[model samples]
Target: MIAREWKCRVPEAHAEGFTAYLYETGVRDSSATPGFLGAQIFRRPLIGKIELTLVTYWKSLDSIKAFAGEDISRARLYPEDEVYELEPDVDVQHYEVIEHGFIPGGL
Candidate 1:
């Protein structure tokens, strides 16, 4: 499994709306993609900024490339994202998931 993460900082006032937009767009689209396993969003509120991390799981790098294009490390952006005043990282990080497990029906 491949773990991919992208980070960005948003103005406090716009953080909530931006998170919603991400879920409605990126997360939603990713969920429907082939080889996409899961996605999670993490957030930390700073004094005047909100730090957000979008994490996604993929079956392989090739799957990621299908979603992110030839340069899989590059961050993907939408035109509407400018409204949130996001300062996004230029590249995303990917890691090889060494170990992970979940109990069936635990939720």
Candidate 2:
């Protein structure tokens, strides 16, 4: 499995709008993608800023490539993102899954 993670710094005022856009735009598309397993979005609120992180699971590297293009290491922002993130510090990360755990104790 492959993990695709993105960290973004968004303006405090646009947090809600940006979060809404994220889910309505790329995430909705990604969720329906063939290799998409799951996605989690995180938020950390500060006095005047906010930090957002998106982590998504993919079945394989090829799946990631199809979603992110050949330059997997590169980061890009959606054009609609500009309305919320005036200055976005975005980062895309890739991880190699070594192992996964099961419900040893049961749910």
Weakest ten-residue segment in model 1 by summed lDDT: 24-33
In model 2, the clashing pairs are none
TM-score per candidate: 0.91, 0.83
Candidate 2: Cα lDDT at 105:
88
- For model 2, how does the per-residue alpha-carbon lDDT over 1-107 read when each residue is reduced to its tens digit? 88888888777888888888889866887787789988889999877978888888899988877777788776656887777754554557899878866798888
Model 2 score (lDDT): 0.80
* Cα lDDT, all candidates: 0.92, 0.80
Model 2 worst lDDT window (10 residues)? 82-91
lDDT of 2 at 17: 85
Q: Write the per-residue lDDT of candidate 1 for residues 1-107, one digit (tens) a residue.
A: 99999999999999989999999888988788899999889999888999999999999999898888999889988889889998999799999999988899997
CA shift at 92, candidate 1, in angstroms? Answer: 0.3
Model 1 sits at a Cα RMSD from the real structure of 1.9
